[model samples]
Target: MKRNPVRVTRAAGDIGAQLSAWRRMQSLTAVQVAERANISRDTLRRLEHGDPGVSWGTVLAVARALGALDRVVDALDPFQTDLGRARAAAALPKRVRQ
Candidate 1:
């Protein structure tokens, strides 16, 4: 199946909006967050606007500055639940012996 690039772009924009909203809620300016994250203000602006060309490390730095690194870790954590393990195991095809 083919995926829609436009839909992916929209999702990225939504993520950027959420990040901007979170930063605003914390009473921090883009410059402040960018400086603390050691990123350029323009880079931060592009990220906030979902430019899609930003690097993963830049995003990670911004997230860390926003005190959202824990949430990112939680989202990627593999051992949080037994159900995930079961699902992963079930997805593997059984091996056959000669």
Candidate 2:
């Protein structure tokens, strides 16, 4: 399957911007959050800029460090997705066509 890098990159950038804002709102410095997440400040900076070069674990750790891990988990929860529920329903054949 083909993937669109632009869309992915844009999403990452948006998330990073939000994260950066959250850090500021919580009066956190990059070093503070990075220390909490057990990552380097450089890594945290890359994440904040939405570089997409960081590990998924690092992303989750960042969220955890900021006490927003629940949001991250909810974002990826398939059961909470209406489109997924609709598509899953469509996948099940209600009657045999043959």
Off by over 4 Å in 1: 1-4, 78-83, 88-98
Candidate 2 weakest lDDT stretch, 10 residues: 1-10
Residue-wise C-alpha lDDT for candidate 2, range 1-98, written one tens digit per residue: 55559988898888888888889999999999999999999999998998866788998898999999999898898768999888878897889888
- Say which candidate scores most in lDDT: 2
Per-candidate RMSD vs. true structure? 5.6, 5.4
Q: What is candidate 1's lDDT per residue for 1-98, written digit by digit as tens?
A: 55559977797788789889989999999899999899999999999898777888988899999999889789877766798778878886688678
How much lDDT does each candidate structure score?
A: 0.87, 0.89
In model 2, the clashing pairs are none
TM-scores of all candidate predictions against the true structure: 0.76, 0.79
